[model samples]
Target: MKIKVVFLLVVELLVVIVVVVVVVVVVVVITVAIAVAVVGVVAVVIAVCVLRVNFVIVKVELVIVVVVVVVVVVVVVVVVVLVLVLVVVVLVLVVLVREVTAEVGYSTGSSVLELVFVIVVVVVVLVVVVFTISFVVRLLVVAAVVVVVVVVVVVVVVVVVVVVVVKVVVAMMVVVVLAIVVVTIVVIVKVFVVIVVVLLVVIEGEQVVVVVIVAVVAMAVVVLLLVVVVVVVVVVVVVVVVVVVVVVVVAVVVTAVLVAVVIVGLVVPPAEQNF
Candidate 1:
């Protein structure tokens, strides 16, 4: 009789231990899935949006995305199979607990209904905890994805602004060099005109000097406008990049802290229950 009671106690402990293990395993699997999904989505975005920037980086990100997706799918399928097996195992254990409790109750003349109720309550609480943890994991995944997207968008915007700034600088440099060339030509024409007007007394030389002066003035105005435009663009781009980087950094830090908190919650509870 004592042996049977000890056996029943052992069985009950096993049931609780098994349920806790299953819960931990399921949580772990789901966490991995969340990580993979978040990372894969980020990689895909980087690969697609910034493909022209760096071929090697894009290719590497794409490969990572593919590997992450494959790993996630395999993990999910395995978790599903594991859950099914756990359900079967739990049911079998429940039946065994019931039979053992019945035999013990019949011999010891004690009610078995209380033990059954406790088992049901434990199972229900575990289910609720699992669902809660799952919900938190989902939220974490969404937060991580949002953080990544913001960072990526900021980076892309920075790249675009830098590209535009570079092009503007190149265009401005070309305009400045062209203006200097035009000024040099205007000076040469003036000297030639003086020589020609004095030596040859040609009427067309004065008109040619006037035309060259007007062309030089026009080039100077165009160069001034380009410089002003370039300066404004550079200032605006610098300000925007600074603001965006700050915002992205803050968002990433907050998201990371939240993820860490949720991970601790998941890990600590299972460990405490197991002990």
Candidate 2:
């Protein structure tokens, strides 16, 4: 009995150690991924705002998207592989414990085995749930960012083309009309931002409050810029300022949420099961 108890304790200790190691590995991986993502976002911002190279902008954006997809896939794969490894380790431990107990004339090791199995299953379930939620939250944020970027880009391009055509074919009055259109688009963007935030909050609840705050701050900045644009009636200035502010805010907000999800997901409560 003493030998069996000792072996059971060792098995439990090994399981705990494995879990801790896995968590640490996951946290490290997420931290590195976040760093890479932030770097990519910064590069994109520089390409758009500072360098102002059109091709560079397209390249950086593509790189960011590809990097994000790869990182997510790699993280999920790492997690699943590690979980499988843990399961295998636990199975081996279970078998060893059963053999040891049986050889010692204590054949009823099923209860202990059941308890360990339950713990492993519970751990796996919690991990899957956490990652799934995190992934969904991230997908929503990325979608919102993409929507904002695409709309802004399409509108800006259309407005620029119209302004050029109007400059050649119409009077200065047409330019004024285009200015009004730009301001109207700015307002529309603000409203869209609010709607997206509300939808995200409703869908994800607690973890998404960070995104709401970010959207509100972005709107406030845009509003201030709008006042300036209205006073100066400068289309070029408004376009550049709005683009920079929106892109930066989106990047920062997404990065913040990624970190939040990582922390939230890793925090699994200790499971206790009485068999």
Candidate 3:
């Protein structure tokens, strides 16, 4: 009986030790997990701050690019307007020459209808170019929006495009009436910066599991950003190409007509010689 009682005592002591060891192990695990979570949160905060700084830098560079583009477009529009004016003036001179020569028994007038048509073409080209510039400016804004959303986690996004020099059309109208004088395109794409701070908290969950959750979330965000950025870049390129092609077509048509006018003005007079 004594031997059996001693055996029972030993067994009870072993059970207490085992329970104490398990409690200690659980406490240590919890402490380590808490520490890891704190560190992870700190790292996340630091990353967010760094990302914001980089975003600002990118924005400044984009603004500079926008300024350069605006200047180039303005210069191009001015040149086109000048060329169209020259064509009109030349057409007028030719018409006057035809009228005077006709009074002295010259042949039929060369191109009264042609002059009218050329004016119409010039006007159409001007409108299209003006609108094209506007479209590009708008696209730039959209790209910026995409950039912001991809870079940071956007809870809500509101994109707005404000036209600084929207009335290039009005300027073209003035050109039709008076002359091609107003050539100024001021485009300022103002993007309202909204940064939403969402602190990921795993309430009532194991710290290690929470860590895994954070990691998964971060990975997902990164993957999403990459996909969105690629899509945005592709779209921007295609749209830009389309608009550029239209601009090129306008240029080609205008040049071809100008060359024809030069040929007619030169060739017809010398060939006939009666006028």
Candidate 4:
């Protein structure tokens, strides 16, 4: 009777352990699914943000280039107009001076007419030189603006590309780590199941010594599973800070489940009653 009672207790405990394990596993699966979904959403959001940043940066750069080009064109046009007007004015003044010189040479000295003409020529040359220098300076300024725009565009593109690549790499790493963690969980579950079956067989034979020995081994296995989980959590934390939040939640849950199973699954009703 005592042996029968002990067996019944063992069966009840196994049933309870199995139920608890199934529930915990279901919870873990649901949580992992949610985490994966969150990860996918985050990745999509990041990709969209990166594309938007690139678009905005390109649009702003294009506008800047267009504005610079327009300003340069306006400046050159104004300078050319001014130069043309100055040349026309100088030509008119020369023609008038020539007429005056012809008239003056008859009344005034030819030397006086020559001197006035030389001064007029010198004034026109100075004005032309100044205008030419102003045009050249404007060209240089426009060139400088173009070079600055090119450099700024290049730098912005490089920064955006690097940011996007880094984010992609981090996301990939998180997924890989999660896969490893899932495999670990599955292994822990398998080990627990094998240990439970072995216990069922050993305890059925009414071998107290075998049961005690198997129970010790089972405890060691449970400890090992917990350690594996801890190591995985540490690895996840080290690999990426961003993934730690989700992975840590999973680690806590799985560890709790392992602890519960180890304690409950190993429990055996007191075999003190006489058989």
Candidate 5:
């Protein structure tokens, strides 16, 4: 009985050891499977995060591109509008000039002489203006020319009329002097003495000096008027030259700018396609 009991205890110890070994092996396998599942879940989460970040970056870049396109379109439209406005203004000015010229050229049928005079005056004024340095200088020169011309013309006419009227007086004086010369020799001598005395008094007196001074002053006034006219003409000419130079330079620069704009406009993609 003692031996049988000992054998039974040994058998029970072996079965317990085998069962514990089996249970330990099952627990290790289950832990390994759980670790693999956790690793897979972590990998999936990281991949999702990376993909989401890339998607966000792409969306932001797209938005930025869209905003830039919108701004460029707006700028192009504004530039085009401004250029059109400038063209219209230039056209209007050209038309107005043509119309005014036409109207002046065709205005009246009966006043041909008057029209010719007017045309001549206008041409003279334009010539003077074109020669001047600035608009203000041109105006001043034109005014001075008109005033001087009128004054000179009036003075010349007056002098001519005065000379004509004095011709008879000068002829009578000559005849009287000749008659006195033919009269009595003593009477001629006395008359000659009296004339000499009177002539000496008038020529040597302050009155004669005053008359000379007045004549010199009148001549100086005329000379001064002439000088002013010449100076005005010179200034007008210089101004016109300067204006022409400036206009040429401005026209060249504007033409270059226009050409550049045209090139850019043609080369650039259309507004809708630029985006």
Candidate 6:
């Protein structure tokens, strides 16, 4: 019985030792499981952080790409717009050239009409000048006729006076006195007619010169007016062309900038999301 009891006690001690070992093994396994869980949680957290970082990086890259794309697109659009505008301007210039050519044709016709009108005016002026000169000549001739009549009357008066003097002097000395009186009357009549002809010729010549000067001034004024009209037409066309080209260029540049911005927005990452 004593041996049996000792054996029983030893058995109980072995059982207790086995239970302790089992408990220690269970505790170690639980600790290992908790450590594994913690490690997994940490790994998941790290993965999430890494993924968030990557996502942010991607978003930033997308934003950058969008901006770059927008810029590129805008530049291309601007270039295209500029080219279109250039083409339009070139077309406009071509049209302007055509219009100018047409205008030139019209102007040529107008110039021809003006030339005809000037010719008519010149012919009329020439006719007027001729008429004026003829009228002046006629007046001068009339004046010459009057002067001739006056000279004849003066000669008649002088002859009558000489005759009376001769009658009175005849009683004193007859032949020499009568011959001197006749020679003096003839000389005075010739001198008076010559003086009147010379004065009339000089006045008519001066009037002709004045008429020619006035005609020349009128022609010069007509020519000046035509020149001014031509200059104004050319200036207006040039100014219109310049303004059109400037407007087209400005529109193209603005359009290209807008296109580039849009393209960049589509390609690049957003600024707020970028690291």
Alpha-carbon TM-score of each model against the true structure: 0.34, 0.40, 0.27, 0.28, 0.22, 0.24
Give RMSD (Å) of candidate 5 vs. truth: 55.8
Ranking by TM-score: 2, 1, 4, 3, 6, 5
Model 1 lowest lDDT segment of ten: 106-115
Q: Flag regions of model 5 displaced more than 4 Å.
A: 1-215, 266-275
- Any idea what lDDT model 2 has? 0.45
lDDT of 4 by residue, 1-275 (tens): 33433343343233323322332332233233334432332332233223333466455444544544454355445434543553454345445544554543321222333343344334433443454344334434433443444332322322332343233334434433443344344435444444555566657857767766786687687658556654755464354444535453443354444434333433433363232
In model 3, where do residues sit more than 4 Å from their true spots?
A: 1-62, 65-76, 109-130, 136-275
Tens-digit lDDT string for candidate 3 (83-150): 45544654554455455445444222224323433554465455546554664455455435544542
Residue pairs with clashing backbones, model 5: 131-236, 131-237, 131-240, 132-236, 132-239, 132-240, 133-239
**What lDDT does the true structure give each of the candidates?**
0.44, 0.45, 0.37, 0.41, 0.34, 0.34
Output the better candidate (2/4) by lDDT. Answer: 2
TM-score attained by model 1: 0.34
Estimate, for each residue in 62-135, the C-alpha lDDT of model 1 and write its tens digit.
45445434644554465456556655665666676668778766222112323433443344335434443443
Look at candidate 5 and tell me the lDDT of residue 24. Answer: 27
- List clashing residue pairs in candidate 1: none
Cα displacement (angstroms), candidate 3, residue 55, comes to 8.6
What residue runs in model 6 are displaced by over 4 Å at the alpha carbon? 1-212, 270-275
* Residue pair clashes in candidate 2: none
Tell me, by lDDT, which candidate is best: 2
lDDT of candidate model 1 versus the reference: 0.44
